[model samples]
Target chain A: MPKLINKNTVITNPWTVMKASTGPEILQVVPGKNFIVPLQFWKLYQEELNEYDGNIAVWLDSDENPEQISDELHSLPLIALNFPVFSDGRSYTNARELRQKYAFKGEIRAIGDVLRDQLYYMAQCGFDTFEIRHDQEAELCLQAFNDFETGYQSTVAEPVPLFRRR
Target chain B: MYRYDGYDHQMLADRVAQFRDQTNRYIDGKLSEIEFLPLRLQNGLYVQRLAPMLRIAVPYGMLSSTQLRKLAYIANHYDKGYAHFTTRQNIQYNWPALVDVPDLLADLAEVEMHAIQTSGNCIRNTTTDQFAGAAPDELEDSRAYCEIIRQWSSFHPEFAYLPRKFKIAVCGTVDDQAATQVHDIGIYIVKGDNDEIGFRILVGGGLGRTPVIGKEIFDFVEKKHLLTALEAILRVYNREGRRDNKYKARIKILVKETGVEEFKNKVTKEWALIKDSSLTLTDEEIDRCQKFFDAPNYQELSNTPTQLTDKLQSNILFAAWHSQNVKPHKVTGYSIVTVCFKETGVAPGDVTDRQLEQIADLSDEYSFGEIRISHKQNIVMADVRQDQLFELWKALESGAMASNNLGLLTDLICCPGGDFCALANAKSIPIAEAIQRKFDDHEELTNIGEMNLNISGCMNACGHHHVGNIGILGVDKKGEEYYQVSLGGSSKNNASLGKIIGPSFAQEEIPDVVETIVGVYKEKRIGEEKFIDTYNRIGIDPFKEKVYAKAD
Candidate 1:
């Protein structure tokens, strides 16, 4: 099983991704088990999400808006942003908007195509849990964070730049 | 030049360390080549056709003598004993082993320099006019804001990855020497109605596949709100730019698809959110950035030196060099001297370690121990004293660095095409050499006058063929190379893309076609109208008729 990483430490991955399904073939999300469903499913099956007694987590596509689902953050265990491919990076700014403006308190996870080189930037933009590809070594991904110790811009983790601190 | 503080030093040092680890990881089979590509690119290492080419950023084209010497040291030690200066004001070492790039980064860090953002699909190095601080007509010194943006954009977590590479050019001069109109983001510094200086923000302008002049989104953004406004634009592009097709991925396509007005509205909404944020430029921060770019201690020479005037009257070559290479400076008795890299037979912008060393010496002796790499791919000693110009010219001639062609036809802007670049469809340097040889006569070239001849191997437009007055694009037809000629492109204040005259030509036909174009212009031109103005008035038919008829 692939483990999630938060600040270079391995943790249990609690969410299962459910891609879009046809009519009457919707996923049977279990109660008390965190599940990550596409944004389309959340809108179509709002009744089901409300009926569930457990936590809900939604993964937003590159073009999707976080503002649509930010109101439901009180009950979510995680808000995962999807990077469909390695080159697609709209999720980076989306992650920043969620943390900086929306004040999201739950775990913000980066999933799909996540690699070791991008971990330092992911962490800086307020992502706590990274869903590394099942093919990647989770232990090796941790080393990416130790390399870059300084940053020029103010991120969610820091309110001011290093120049201001200096 | 902006001096690196302890924080800046630490940040660059940490990047070297990070890149080193990333390099080792890839070598150990821990990271795939696909996964490692962006990482290496962010460090300015490109796996080229021959070997890796490392492009190092020379921010705003300003480099101290110390920094240049270190570049020379790196060139001599790593890969070839030379470096190529790029149109974007970056220095590229065309050959380096991938294994040694991390070590190279470490050495560059010792000089407070790094290859960060030089090649990645991120906000690359911000370029300004080479005479940013020295130009007489400039409304403000733009290097201050460039330095600020450099800091804000460096290691920017959000913009570390973009759909395509983004470039920004800033110019404070009345004449757009930095080609601001053709950049992804062109910041034109100007005075507002109230005499307060601000930037005229332009977006979506680029040259690659579909060349479009950027549209202005704002007449004037206050200096304090500069960073805030830019952050909004970048956020909009980052979120909405196309990711499906790499060719259609630049912010230009997004702006064109969404329309500038709608794109402006999106950016306006984003700017509203961050207007009062910490990214807003405070007076202290602004002053701090500006202090680093303060002019050097210029000697108080009120009048032109008699010795220089005498030399100009006595020597014809010196007079010719002075007429073409010397530009008027804001500070009295100090002139901007352009040292040409476009020697007749040599590859444009390629300078050896010995030339770099010689230039370092020249900078110390003539200018204020400073140098600049222009967008036109030449070096400039922007603050050279008028009295010292004669001596400097003689010294430059001794080093074979003195060429009296600044904007002439032979002074061609060229790309490292098929010979070096992997994307090039054909070789560009040979074409440039051919054209220079055709127009080799000094007096004849002078008589022809003020033409921008540019060559590119492909539509990528690295040579900025789109804006060249007389542009050449090399196309491959059935495994053979052919050249297409375009006319009337300009990158000045009134910038426009070139128009294809007619069919393409063979390698041997380029010079003859160019000569025919010039010949037609000379015959039909009214008074002193240039080739561009003549083409604009009489249209391409006359030149087309002359060339095609000859070819047939």
Candidate 2:
């Protein structure tokens, strides 16, 4: 099992992230396992997913708006924001909107293209957990959170900008 | 100038330490070059043609003597013995080792400076009028708001990784010396109907492959709602801006594609949610930032004193310099002296380590230990006493900084193009040099006065060619270099982008083309009309016909 940073601590990730497979075949939801589905897949098969006994969470791609799941937010345990590439930053806005705009209290996890250098900023944008990219050492990446003790702008961690706080 | 408090010091220290670790990781091969690109760029490091260019941020172009001296030391010790002041009011060191950057950053941190957010797909250094505090026509000192924006935009976690690089410029004066109209976000500090200070916000303006003037997004945003409003705009851009193509990723494209009205509506909707949040500025905080930019202690005296008048009458050189380089200061007895960097053979904005130290000393002696870097890539001693004009002129002349051409054709803004930049299509320095040599006669240049000649090596438009009165863009013609000339751009209160005159010219013919264009302006002028005035009055057709006719 791969380890992920959850709420600033490394832990074994229980949820299996299902990416859209090659070709147009629809992804099947396996029973009795924690699974995070793509937002479109989750939305398309919500009734079928509701009948399954497995714990289901929705994941959004960089282009997917978090508002799609706003109506049923309280039911999901986690909402994963995908980076596709670390430089593609739309997911950061998605995470912030999930937390601040939609008031989604469930876990907001950063998935795909996640790296040590971006962990601090990801955390700042209301991402409670990060699924460290498979190539990165998750244990060492834990130290990324402490890279900056403070920032000037308002963040999920600190809602007040530095000027107001000062 | 705003002095660093403990919090500011701590933040910079943490940033330096963070960069040091990132550098070590890269050296150890733990982080791949692809992954390290944004990390290095966010710290203002770029792998250029010759060496790694490190751009150090001078917030709102304000520099204290101490900071200037520190930069001089860095130039002398860390990299080459020279530095280039960029069009964004930041300074770029062209030759610096990638390994030594962390230590260089540490040295800069000691002077309350860092290279953070100077580049990369993040919010860049916020710029303002070089004469923000000293200009006679200023509504209020724009530096305070620039400082405010600087703090808000610095390491803005969500906006840090935007689709493209963002720029914001603030103008407090009636005259737009900062060239705000061409920035991603141009802020004009204005008075509300009730006399409350606020900002007129313009969005989507940029200069690059596609140059577009900013649209007025909001007529007035109250002082308190500034950051929140900016936040809304950034949020809209961050989520919706084009990321598929880097060339079309600027906010301008989004504004254009979405239509300005629709974009404005989106931003307005977003702003309503966050406008009254904790990010809203308190009067105390505003005052706190404002206090740092308060007027310097001025000894009141006559505008042009007896001593200055006598010196101006006695020496023609001093008189010429005063007539061109000096401008009236908001405070009587003081004058704003532009220390020209456009010497005939030199790169427009390049300054030697020795010149940097000399400028620091000069600032301390003549301008209350303060200096400003103009967007035109020149230095300004904003508070020089009029009585000491002769002495200052003599000092500047001795240092070879007293070129009596503040706005003449020779005082051009040319980018460090093919010589240093990896993206350049052609060399801009030689072209700038050729034009400067052609227009070397002081009397002729004075007659062809107050014209902006800007050159960019590529479509990046770092030299601000889009807003220059006369502009040049270097293009790669079948792997060979050619130059495209444009006419009638102005980056003032009424900003306008230049129009391309005609077909491109070979490198050798650029000087003659410029001369022919200037000739047309000189001949067509009714009376005392500037190059831009004449070009605008007669239009580009006359100049285009004459240049091509001469070519045939």
Candidate 3:
């Protein structure tokens, strides 16, 4: 698994993405491994997912509504939003909605097509952890976190805007 | 005029260094050409038909004398000894090397300026009225608000990767001289019912292949809520804006697809969550930016100076220039003078290095060491005394910057067409020259009255042909260059797109066709009616019948 960088520091990645499957074994979570179920699959097997003993997480596509999973968010360790393309940027808003609107305190992760160039902005919009592509250099990408020392507008991390501070 | 603090200064330095690293990576082949295209564009670098072109932002069309001198230095030492001002109130260097661009940006960053967001899918320059603070009829100065928006949008986290080039314009009056109706987002600063200052927000207005006047999203948004409302709109656009098709991905398409009321609902929904956040401007913050745009010191003098009256009585050319080039100002003794770069045969907005330095010197001598670039492609000195108008006119005439045509037919709003841009269909410069030569006589053009003749070499509408009174578009017919004509478009208060006239004309016939169109306008017009007014009164059919009368 690729290393997860959260807030400019590398962290151990524990969650394994569970592909959509209806197998009998799919409902049984491994004792040590955490499973990140897609929102669709999670909706279909909510009771099965809730009963599992290991850590549980939810991942969403660009079209998935954040409000749909709000009740289940308390049972999850983190919410990962998939970026089909880096330029699409729908997931950034999804992340923002998760943090600001729903008040989801658990970790917010960005996955799929995530790149080094976009990590800084993702961080600004409230993504704490990034699941970078396996082939990319994670350490080098982390440098983007501090690309600019300051920003004019406020973000999730910095509540006071530059203008307000001035 | 907004001064940069240490934080802004360091950010600029860091951005330049980041770009230099990106350039190095591209040169090392670590980043492919396709991968580097958007990166270079965000920095205002374009690989054109000729050499690479670099466009530098002049925020809200305001530039200091020191900035102009720095530009002159760049033009003389780096590229050719000239720079071209664009319709969006920015300057373009035609021949900067691809590698030298980062160095050029470093030079620009020294003077509290950089080329960030000048060209990209992100938000471009925030243009305002050239006479923003000076115009007597304006309600409030819009420059500080524009500066606020600029800072907010610059390197914005979510909005840096928008679908297409986004343009925003602000105007402080009903005049709409900045062509607010044709930008992506337009802000009109106005007084509310209780005499409170607010903005009338318009969104999705643009002038490309699909010409649409922006719809008013909000009739009034309070001053503190400006950033929140804007953020909401941008967030909606970023999340829901079409990304599959490059051409159909502008916010206009999203606004069109969602409908205005529906789009407003979506933005209002987003605004509810972020309205009370840190983005809301404090009164102190507003006052901080407003202080920079405060009025310059002026000496008490007569509105009608004796020297100016003597010059007007003696020199006919000087009097004619004063009547056209000078605009009324808020101050009694001062007037805003537009130093026209449209000297008949020369390109509309091209200025040489020497002229740049000289204009800087002129700004120091006459105006308060500041210059403004108008959307109509001209330079403005806003604080010149009426007594010094004659002397300023004399200096402008010596440098071939004195042209009495401010809004006439020869004052062409044209793009660097097939000559410089790779995407153009024909040569726009030669077309401008041809039309200028055709109407070389001062008396004939003056008789024609107020008319707009805009030219673009392609459908991208950089020349804003869609909003011109008499619009011309260059089309590629087989292998030859052909010109298409449109009539009755206006970007003023009553914003409307031009209708295409029948049959395209060849290069040689363009001037004659323009003359024929103008001939119909002059004949059909009532006493002292402008061309747009005449076209609006007597529909396009009469002129269509006249010009295509011979061809058909």
Candidate 4:
């Protein structure tokens, strides 16, 4: 399990990503079964506000209009989006816009192709939680977030503009 | 020659510290290769086929003697004791280790330099005329404006992650030595009818697989609103530039898709919102930047030196060099000397550490402790006294820097081909060597007059081969290297891409092909007419017939 850092707090990430399985053990949105809402599911089930709980995480496409999601649903406790590939940085912008512009104050997580190099940028863009691949060492990737103590530009994490810094 | 102010210094120092931390995290296994790639690239670090290539920005090609020495030191201590000058007027070290880059940047920062925005999808180092303040035709020093743009674009929040990398070039002279027309944005500073100076803006010009001449957006942009206007253009590009395809992502594609009129309307609509904002320049700030580039104190002397005249009449090599490599400066008795890098058997822009140190010393002694790297891949000592020509030439000769082939056939602008670059389709260095060998005689070269022969390893056009008078493109056919030839292309005020002459030939046949083209020019040219003018008058058919005669 990867250690998730929010502000100064560090805790073990609770989500378990498993390959597709069939039967009662499939775990379709059980009480404790943390689930990631795919783009298709978010589009289909977003209207049925009562179906999903605060614990249900939803994935949002970078190009999708964030306004489509009801503001009340933003109070969900967890959310994770797919990065798709190393070069597909749209997810970072999506994560940032969701947190800063839309004011979604929940635990935004990064999933799929999320590598160590992007940890700092992802954190700056307001992703507090991360679900890295099972094959990678999550502890080492977590340390990469603070690689640079100072940045020349302001980000969502650091709202103070560069010019305002002494 | 923009001096570093407090803010500029602070920004660079902070960026260096930030990159240092990034490097530490990568080394500590905290960052994965995918995560760190963009951050490292934005800092001008690239993993080439052989080793990590670090590109240090030389803002507008102007450098102080102190900066040059630091570069020399870095080259000697870190890399293979040599550095390659890039077409973008920056220097690239071909063999810097990933671990030592932060330290290398710290060395650079001591001289007020950094590698920020040198790569990635960001505003790149702005290039301008090397002879900015020294050129006789210059209306104002373009380097001052280039510095202003550099300051404005450095770590700009909005434009950092554009659709593709952006480049801008400024030229103050009518001659257009900076190759302005081929940049993403080309700004030409001109004096208005009211005796005030402003800019003529050309947007969407670029050279690559697809070459397009920039269309003029504004005849005169008031000097004060320069930054605001630039901001508007960048905003539009950031919002609408294509992201689906890398090749079609440049601003040119957007401009072409939405015709020039519509594009102009969009820019105008955006500009009206912020035209009078704080981004607009004040006269006080412009004058302050101008102060750093104030002309050096010059002693009045006769334009022609008696000793130089006597030497020129006696020594043919000296006479040839003086005619080809030296240009008349705005100051009397001082000349701008171009040290050509297009030497035979050497890569076009490769200079050793010893050569760099020597040039730094020469700049201190002869010039004003300043040097400029020309877009044609040559170095210019912009303030050499006429009396010191012989001594300077002698010093240059020791290091093979006095090539006397500036603007000649041997002065080829070539990219590092298959030998170093993974993207190259074929090798380009051997073809350049063959042509250089073919035109070895100084007297013959002098007679041939000013000519530009450019070669690219691939269609990426890193060498700016499209604008060469005689352009050579290396193409691969079943793993064999073949060269395509073009004619009459230029990058000056009347900028035009070259026209291909017919079929491609094997590498060995390129020198002979070049020789035959030169022969045609020699046969048909009018008195004092250049190879370009002659080819332009007679058309490509004559040369095409001669070159492809045996093949046909």
- Most accurate candidate by TM-score: 2
DockQ of 2: 0.84
lDDT of 1 by residue, B153-219 (tens): 8989889889899999999999888989998999999899979999999999999889999999999
Runs of candidate 4 with Cα error greater than 4 angstroms are: A1-61, A64-166
After superposing candidate 1, which stretches have Cα over 4 Å from the reference? A22-32
TM-score, each model?
0.97, 0.98, 0.97, 0.84
In angstroms, give how far residue B273 of model 4 lies from its true place. 3.4
Candidate 4 at B291: error in angstroms? 2.1
User: Candidate 3 on A2-54: residue-level lDDT in tens?
Assistant: 66788667889888877655342665535545878888878777787667777
What is each candidate's DockQ, to 2 decimals? 0.71, 0.84, 0.67, 0.13
Which stretches of model 2 miss by more than 4 angstroms?
A22-29
- lDDT against the true structure, per candidate, is 0.88, 0.91, 0.88, 0.81
Q: What lDDT tens digits, residue by residue, belong to model 1 across residues A1-166?
A: 5568888588876678766563313435345555688888877888877776656678888889788886786577778898787677789899899987788888888888887778888888888888888877777788877766678787887758755666
TM-score of chain A of 1: 0.89
Candidate 3 residues B382-436, lDDT tens each? 9999999999998988887889988888987999999999999988989999999
**Which has the better lDDT: candidate 3, or candidate 4?**
3
Model 3 ranges off by over 4 Å:
A18-32, A51-54
Q: For chain B alone, what TM-score does every candidate structure achieve against the true structure?
A: 0.99, 0.99, 0.99, 0.98
